[model samples]
Target: MSRLRFLAVPAAALLLLSACGDDDAGGTTSPATAAPTSPAPDAPGTTDASTGPATVALSDDGTHLVSAEGRSLYLFTSDQGTTSACGSGCLENWPPLVAA
Candidate 1:
């Protein structure tokens, strides 16, 4: 019973590691490929009101938002609404999204 329990732990860990590997190969996506190749249909350069300069794109899981240039958009939890809380030094690392 003790040997079975020890083996079970290793087996579970291996399964988790294998699952993580599949994300990079099968489930994971590069930022370049995630965005649209051409401009969206609504306007010449606009995607939508909510997303602003960003447009929605399809992924393995579902639809997600990306920048006009096809870069992935990430929201900062530290910010309040559309306002940015990050300082200039921090902005160097995480640039704020601005309207074009």
Candidate 2:
């Protein structure tokens, strides 16, 4: 019984040490796959996903207007939300169909 106890203690220690040995049997972990993120929310009075110049709305007088940032459109307006009177000078600062 005393000899068995001596053997048991050493065996248990060896078993524990063997279990904790450096074993890289498992392959390296590849990076986790992440889902594609959608575009961020639009700012106040802005639009998204409409890149470049696209005619958004027609002027009351039937003049064509281009949208800015495909979201926030700038047009010649005598009143609010109007796009009819943007002169060449104004268009220079806010070019129509300009890249973002």
Candidate 3:
């Protein structure tokens, strides 16, 4: 519902924020998790599992992180420290990953 969407935005923002810090000024990105040797699963995730933690899996090439649905993930250079800069029109192209 509307409430979920509202909460999801902040959740997504926090995830984006964690992807960067003062140490990596060179713009290097760390994968949230180790890339699995296995191939990605067939589906994204169950909508009912809202309480579960959102997870990102590795794509087949092992070059980058991907959504459970297999969409390539990205971060904006405009974001500084623990803040997320992508919003509005930006989100239309790069939708944030929500826990549920």
Indicate whether candidate 2 or candidate 3 has the larger TM-score.
Answer: 3
Whose TM-score is higher: candidate 1's or candidate 3's? 3
lDDT of each: 0.51, 0.44, 0.59
How well is each residue in 1-100 modelled by candidate 2, as lDDT tens digits? 9999999999999999999997765434322222233332333333443452233433333333323222344433452332334455554555433322
Model 2's number of clashes is: 3
Candidate 2 lDDT (Cα, 0 to 1): 0.44
Model 2: per-residue Cα lDDT at residue 43: 36
What's each prediction's TM-score?
Answer: 0.34, 0.26, 0.44
In model 2, how large is the Cα lDDT of residue 6? 94
* Top TM-score model: 3
- Give the per-residue lDDT digits (tens) of candidate 3, residues 1-100: 9999999999999988887745533343434643332221123332433445557866666677887677987756887664557666566667666543
In candidate 2, the residue pairs with backbone N, CA or C atoms under 3 Å apart (3 or more residues apart, or in different chains) clash, namely 47-71, 50-70, 76-84
In TM-score terms, candidate 2 sits at: 0.26
Q: What lDDT score goes with residue 6 in model 3? A: 100
Provide the lDDT at 16 for model 3.
89
Report how far residue 26 has shifted in candidate 3, in Å.
Answer: 30
